[model samples]
Target: MTCMQLLLYSYPYVTRFDLRRLMGQKIKLTKSTIDKLPIPQMGARVDYFDTDCKGFGIRVSSNSRRFFVLKRVKGKLTRVMLKPYGVITPEQARVEANKAISKLYDGIDINAEKAKDNLKGMTLADALKKYFETKTLKPRTVENYGDLFRLYLDDWLHKPISGITKEMVATRHLNISNQNRKAAANNVMRTLRAVYNFANELHDDTLPPNPVKRLSNTGQWNKIERRQTVIPAKQLPQVFQAIQKLENPVIRDYILLLLFTGARRREMACLRWESVDLEAKIFTLMVTKNGKPLILPMSNFIYDIFNKRKALRENDYVFPGHGKTEHLIDSRKQVNAITQITAVEFTLHDLRRTFASNISGTVVGGYELKRLLNHSFGNDDVTAGYVIHSIEKLRIIMQEATDHLLMLCTAGKKINE
Candidate 1:
């Protein structure tokens, strides 16, 4: 057979004896040596070579460099280069080649088996797409997580989740903190911990404990003081009066709905008429940050506002818009509108914040405020699984709170007064 055919036929099966003979023969047995090598019938490649080595029984030449690759379980093939062409003697290559031959004879498909292993040490970016698929987070929340990963975890995402050290987390925190982003740094650490925890659950291995634990000790993670910007409970009447003077009926009802229900901006904007049960006096928000359907009882003002909205279409949203996903997209424009009319510098979110503020310190505990805001309490040993048994109590407080806002909006009600 021609040397080319010989090399093509035998490669990977080329024995030490065969190599010896070919090298000894001085016939430049390029194709002959390859033809004798024993390669898997299906996976054999033109430039590929695998040989037994001390640790790596199967070595594959990637880009013409010979190396010892450790492909454990089922994963992508990885290699450790043995020696440079001129650095290692041909005898060394032959010896290494023999080791690979030995491994093949032992009937181990290490290369192929390793190629099938689970994704370990994958970067954050590599696994995020998969992560996003199963998460039920709100769009804004999911976007925030994506932003954090893109901004902070670019270098570390590809790191095997198993290999992330506390030091690495601390270093990332330090870098972000040094950049005058203490809150962002803490958030990064928090995201890392959450991702690692998720990976640990998915992987069959134990995850390293969160490094953020140390951050808490160092006071790096601070309790963010909630912003309290709600129009006062007693200030709603004046606010309502001011709202009524606005010429746009849509803006009038929108601002009233927000002040009355204390609903999150997006939650109210995305509200479907189908999700509202006017007879039951409750509106259901299907996808909340806590991944639970939130049932919010409507106040008299909210019910009346919905009652006045003119609609007949079966699939019509309460608020329609061309913004993202067809719900009255964002409340920012409404916020700006209200600010221009009422001369207040508050965001729609600030309305929720105002709701929280007005409720707290007046027969409403932080825990109660959290419930109204649909926040999930931490899984503390003592607090875990403790259901909020105060929905009715919350409703009464919210009713009182909404009534208070009504008084504020109408307070200075004489048109321009």
Candidate 2:
């Protein structure tokens, strides 16, 4: 016989419940049997158990009734709530109870095992909730993480976080890479790595080391090429004319600001009116990709674009969203329209790269261009520490690049000279 059968044979007198009877047997607590039990008139829950089912019990109060399993280990009582009445039937509760009883008789503390199961219960979905609560992340970053989870780990989300294995991650990486979405595959693993990192911190002793760590050792990561596309000097004029002809004034100015400032799409997207100081010819960014404050001097042409936007100064955002958020996020439609009009076939970052290429070696030296672009070269460069470009100095360099770009674009036709 099993430990459950052995326990039921021994614990006959421990059940003192004079609960309603079920045929000739010790009333197996069910919906019908539970309804027959007396309501505890003192505003406390009344419990009833089946003599045949060792750990099963039905707890009833005036407001609610629940099924629970009670396991006694080392003379201490442990209770685990199975579910509400209609949620799980009496037969289901008994099945769960017998399982708990089997664990208890095997020299195991049901409470401790349940606690271990709780850590084991930490699903990827639950881990994400904990991660969002604990980590300070950018709003866009948090959204992207969720998208990664939904896209890649939809099947794994409900599984226990601890149950994720290295082999599983490896298979996923290979499968995703096969679809030709190399960057997305790499990003999905990186995002899961962050989730596992958070799990390690939260469940210090319980969670296994992150499974995604094997990707680097196994050489599973995809190689992504950095794009070096730029607008050739001759094509820029026609591109400018196409931008000016487009309808949305906001989009027209936004494209011009990006080309002129070389700012990231998100930085420009989340721009606030307070960050721009037209009089000082400077723009202050509170947050950058590197977590540093980047203050860029607005070119005279970019300053003019801001000057016309002053009429719509009632809102706090430079680009207002149609939704609850203040800033505009949907720039793809406008960008595609501009691309069709100009046939430039460029992304926002391409414009930023075009700015870097236009001025990097010509208008300014390589080191000064790094400062203007807000790129961090490692501290090993002793000469770099000493070289600092002021806003006024950068303003001059920026103006040179803007003048060169606009002069090429506004030339009306391609100037070979």
Candidate 3:
């Protein structure tokens, strides 16, 4: 077989040999002498130690023989693979092994140090699998990891975790940001950061430190703009009227409820019938992104919307998807259709912004607005501790917001006198 084909067929099988079967029989090592030696039994390895070099040895299996150094540190034994036989002369192994053994004598753990260096060959994709095996993550967070690693950053999966340079990460982040969006780039790098950190802990000293850190260290991480788009006050009536014209009650009520409550799209999409308390006018999210379950007061309008959705419910999910994800996947097209009809260009999140804006300075205090939005203003604000509002107080605030939205929805429609 050709040299390239020989390596291609044998490399994987050679790496699988149980080198631990090494019996450590000492021999006076030489290149010609080692070459003349017989191969061991299939799947097993035998160690031929050198009498002249204390830690120097050669491991021979059926497929290949390799030179290695072994040392005992802190009462634990470790082996460091050096070079494959035929690639390195026995004299070369002897000289290299002497230097490594001297370090062991000086109390340095050469094998452990070598182990750290082995991390340089481990790919980012391998680290992700190892991280998943070691950590328990939220399902949504797990999904995000899959998206970042497998979908978005697939090109980098095979690259060594330790080999990813700071320049590579920075330029890649910038490229992804330009090609996709800033948020996508940020999230991709954030997941890369997590996977890189796990691999660093796994390899410790051997691999190069995380390249993702350069973004933070140099303050070059993209400062993403917080979108503040909202349907204008004058456009609310036009928007609501367009929503009213939609044929599907599912999409209609879905858009209306979002405008009224300002709950995130995924939060609303994942809602279940059991979480809704119609009589109490409250929606309970048993598990939320922040791990805090929301017992949010729903205004009469949202309560009425839920009542309609409940009757149409064919599944546990509030907005059950027809395809693989099994939840309302993307409402971008539905939202864009509404935008077209009303000439009010808006995102689903804009409905959230609209809810907050319409209710602010109109029906309740700023703190109450934050409460209605289920927002946690930073803990740095001392008065945030004392501004807690009860459900009854929040209910009053929610009712006012609901009533105001209704007026906007019906503003220009005159009743027959």
Better of 1 and 2 by lDDT: 2
lDDT (Cα, tens digit) per residue for candidate 2, span 1-417: 543333233344333342223112346686688777654433555566776786777776666778777776778787877778777777787787787777777767766666666766789999898899988988878999999999988999999888999999999999999999899999999999988888766666567778998899888889999888988888887788777877877777778888888888777867888998888988876657877878989787778888887776547878666777766767778778877877878888898998888877778898877877778988898899888888899888888888877776777444333
Candidate 1 Cα outliers beyond 4 Å, as residue runs: 1-121, 133-141, 155-181, 197-219, 233-252, 278-282, 312-315, 340-343, 356-404, 412-417
Give candidate 2's error at residue 334 in angstroms. Answer: 2.5
- For candidate 3, give the lDDT of residue 61: 80
Candidate ranking (TM-score, best to worst): 3, 2, 1
The better-scoring model by lDDT among 1 and 3 is 3
Regions more than 4 Å wrong, model 3: 1-118, 213-220, 412-417
Candidate 3 residue lDDT tens string, 205-267: 455777889899988778888888888888787888788778877778878888888877777
- In model 2, the runs with Cα more than 4 Å from the true position are 1-117, 201-209, 412-417
Candidate 1, residues 1-417: lDDT per residue as tens digits? Answer: 654445445455666566445431322223344334344334332323333233332222323334343433234343434554345544565566556545555556645444335555455665566567766656777788888987988777666666767777777788887888878877877776676666656554455665567777676565656665656546455455666766655556666676566677767767788888778777787656566777877666667777876443324677776654765665556456656766657666766766666666774677666666778777673563665555566667667766655545555354245
